[model samples]
Target: MPSFSHDPLSPKDAADVVIVGVAARGLAAAARRAGLRALVLDLFGDDDTRELALAAIPLRRIGAFAIDPADLYEQLAIHAGPDIPVVLGTGFEHQPEVVERLAARFRLVGNGPPTLAWTKEPLMLARLLHNLGIPHPQVFADHAPAGMRTLEKRIGGSGGWHVKPASESRGWGWYLQEELQGRTVSALFLGNGHKARLLAFSEQWCEPSEDAPYRYGGAAGPIRLDPSIEASIASALDAVVNAAGIVGLASADLMLTGDGWSLIEINPRPGASLDVFDHEPLPPLLRLHFEACRGELPDLALLTPEAAGMVRGAGVFYAPFSFEMRLDPLPDWVADRPPQGTRIETGEPICTLFAAGRDVREVRDTLARRRDQLWRDLSMASRKAAE
Candidate 1:
């Protein structure tokens, strides 16, 4: 459990919303910008998350990834009260039935469990994209045909941590997907029950670990694509929204394969790309998400790229030690901050690094330097710890 620096400053009745997920800082921060007091229940009560949230409770998982729903539903009123709307995020993909339970108890604010159940099934998504005439890699349940180039992905997973070379998989709940050679780009969109609108796009990259080879590093963009391709992706996304009955904020991950772009996955809730697309001249995304769920999408003009838009990027910097190291001070460019003096384990994420500039390289370079600095600072701290 994450320790709060202090007790919640207000009673549960004061919260305007409650968010639940593996990580909820970004959602809580968005709520704060929308002038709403958000109570957060997640896997981390990081310094900034606790600060942004009116109250933050660290939720326990039943096993590896699924949040213990009984714990979450039980924690709800005691932390944020009965009537507060609940916004779901990253951790729910593998456990949509828990989503069903939450909806029965609270005013569920985004895609419901039925939609999730339909969309998150790996084979179902592959077939749906194929049925829609949208290009998608072939999905294999038992095995990929002999000599087929493929990769194994967790059945209902996020953060790309579950992806690995097909030869490395032990199967079970995993499925094999034909390998597609290309970079990944995501379209963050608003779905108003019937249709969806693309808010922005971002190119994704990974920071591989020995075990989690395709672990998601971060995303950076509103990157440009050919007009024809953009139209096609938008069309495909709309078809998916209508077909899946998707609602509120979601992102479709598409990869540019040799044949063309292939739709890979649909995150039925707000995702990491929010660190890129959520900003002004745009209304608060958390607010837009609420309105969209209520059956209204933001006017497209408000999202025009020329209005205060610029290339920006965010990257995740993981702890670089086998031993624990206390984070001395939070850097200015960091979000998802663990408290000062908190020890982060080797291979765990320390904080999210942000940078914005005239172009991708500028932001990329700046973020690289930030990571280098953390690498050095944390190294020195590790040495001191050993001493």
Candidate 2:
């Protein structure tokens, strides 16, 4: 078992940093690349994450979908001390106060609470982008905007699981958005609270669940782009980062249409796509993130194209039905694996699949093949378990 408690302030016994998030594997992996030991407050306690972490506490034990801030505070008390750096990942957007509390106790190396507050608020973001003459989908806060292709989205939602048809149902903190037609594209960048640097652009896709159609499936990148489109995106990111005073790792989601890219939202903390872009020979992003937070920008070398004709992709595989995990030995290509014999509900993510190829189509085909192979392997394992 990974250590849950380390001797406070003892470098020999303590982890170098504390990582808290629903998707902590990428952060943990990045930390290890920087030669740092990570104590990860993770939701899944995935098998691969445990291998990379000094400690991987299953935040799922506290709650499946959302985290309780009090539980996180208590867990930190057990595993970390004030000197340790804390980097938050996805899942803290709606709880800025909790981030504020963490900042008061530890050295936070990413954007602080105030950044999340401004960036995640739908109306505020729409207005900011509008003021900057950026294209943004119309946001309706109080009542639904009649006669527009609309979506009902949960406030501060990251993955699209919280989005649904505007006509189906509505609840508190839910706002209506005009659904624009386009390909989903994202810019993974680092900011120094004033100037910004573009890391890479990736294409994002949705893997529809039984309930959620826009649920995030995967992303692939180092995608080369037309110079004009790239310049427009770079300019937009610089403006938003400066206006929001965003620092450290951040991402801007956009809709690339027949006309141009429209701003969707800016994720202020470390994003899920770190796994897509972080690789060998490139300086580990976590190291760059720290430097950026300290007001230093990464070298332009990072913006250079990846090696000719090579691209990488990451995809999530959700369970087809509720079942007990029967694969005893997990595959190398898969990540974020739950323990064998654990029960997983229908539509819940079972693992992540990684693949590489010359272009997007090949990468997608490889991931699909891997997913099929995994399901077949599970069937054989389950039958053997019964025998």
Candidate 3:
């Protein structure tokens, strides 16, 4: 039987929480900040993750993009003690069945399989948005709409990497949607199945490469929004929470276009923006998630001026070429650090760089400078080795 322990500070001998994801560093960090002992399972058991987690295990990768579900289940079953509640992150978004299977075996926190299926289904979400009178991009399942610029996206795909031009033919599990050009914004919220409270609003950016055009680059904010715009988004979210029965931490991706704000998709989990929105004085997000899941909503008054005004940004620094990762005593600014002597292929993400400041522009600038400097340092090291 699954176990539920309200005490986050359980003995270090056993895990109080187990976090599973494609990259679980952020979630593990949040759990640690909340005074919980977390066991992390992900594809990259990065250096920071190991430091934060009681135990860290790498999930098996299938090809360059997919996680092997069987491997994930086997690892979880081996490490997750009976009754230990599991918190899922990025990897299982594409495999709801796997999540369902895991939930059947272990105590799964956050949203259940039904909630995930309801929110992740493109057609269902589009219809819900339409019925709510919210602006949303038109989605077509299994076929492209005639004579309109559309993008092909995979079901259960997160991080925007799975999106491509509709002109290209792909295998099954693909759907087409009208492309919108505008500012990409994400709203992070805490919900209790009936209502949701906004935690932060962030501007999302993508880094397009030859292979992954819509690759998630980074995010910046807790940005101030026009009162009217914020109201509209809040109203949309309220409708969504009631409609989908979303509980705990969730994010809504939308585009502010010439027409208006159009809903993109909903991430029913602790998303990438957790790092940008996480601040002190307020309880850690993972704690808030746990509280909200138990039907308690966090107090919005806890959002202090410092927490709301402070802007944080993170950018993924991709390897410019195939090189071995070698940063001894890794810089404090860099995270998701691969083990030394690990061979990284060209275009693969190297590490994530983070910066925080009072001004969003300054934070973004600092992140950019840091990213460039790290790449230059890597290039110089490579050249020296060759010489």
Estimate every model's Cα lDDT from 0 to 1: 0.81, 0.82, 0.82
- Against the hidden reference, what TM-scores do the models get? 0.93, 0.94, 0.93
- Please write out the lDDT profile of model 3 over residues 1-387, one tens digit for every residue: 113375464333478899988899999899988889898888888878998888788889998756798898788767886588889988777778988898899888888888887788888888888998989898887666567788889888987788888844375677788888998988999889999898778888888988678989899887766678888888889889888899899999989886478889999999888787766655789999998898898778424336565778888888879987655766798988888777889888898889988777788889988888888777776666666
Stretch of 10 with least lDDT, candidate 1: 1-10
Q: Which of 1 and 3 is ahead in lDDT? A: 3
The digit string of per-residue lDDT tens for model 2 on 112-198 reads 877776688888888888998888898887566556778888888878898877743375677878888989988889999987898
Q: Which pairs of residues have clashing backbones in candidate 1?
A: none
| Order of the predicted models by lDDT, top scorer first | 3, 2, 1
> Which scores higher on TM-score, 1 or 2?
2
Q: Candidate 3: lDDT over CA atoms?
A: 0.82
